[model samples]
Target: MQGGTTIVLPEHRGHRLGLALKVAHHQALLARFPDVEWIATATADVNAHMNAVNDRLGIRVVERCIELTRPVGRAS
Candidate 1:
C-alpha cells in the first residue's frame, strides 16, 4: 500500500511519471503475486489528472470512503 501527497512539484509537472509509476507498480505486484485478486489505490476526487490516468488504466471507482473525526470524548 502506498499513499502520495500533493502534485505541485515543478520538476514533475507535465510529466506522467506518477501515473506511470502507479501502473507499473500495480502490474509488478500482480506479476509477483499472481494469486492476488486485486490491487487498490486512492487519490482525491478533485484530482482530475490522476483520475484521467486511472481511467486510461481501466481502474474503476468502486466505493467512496469518507473519514469522519471528532474530538475524543467530545460528542456531538
Candidate 2:
C-alpha cells in the first residue's frame, strides 16, 4: 500500500503528531492486510522531519526520483 502525505498544521507543530499518525496507520494496515508485503511512501528530499519519522518506522530509502520540466513548446 502506498501512503499519502501526512501533514500537521503550523499550530500543531513540534508535538510529534505526524509520527503518531504514521504509527497508527501502519499498525492498522498490518492488522487489516496481513498478506501485504511492503508499503511505499515518499517525502520531499528536504522534509527532514518526515524523513526522521520514516526512519523511526524502519523505512529506508530504496531509490531517489528526480523530476525535470521544460516549456511545452520548447525544442531540445
- Best-matching candidate per TM-score: 2
lDDT of 1 by residue, 1-76 (tens): 4545535366776688767777777777778778877657787799888888788888899999997887766575
- What is the TM-score (0 to 1) of candidate 1? 0.66
For all predicted structures, in order, the TM-scores are 0.66, 0.81
* lDDT computed for candidate 2: 0.89
Residue 70 local lDDT, model 1: 75
Off by over 4 Å in 2: 70-76
Cα distance off (Å), candidate 1, residue 38: 1.7
Q: What lDDT, from 0 to 1, does candidate 1 have?
A: 0.74
lDDT of each candidate versus the true structure:
0.74, 0.89
Give every collision pair in model 2: none
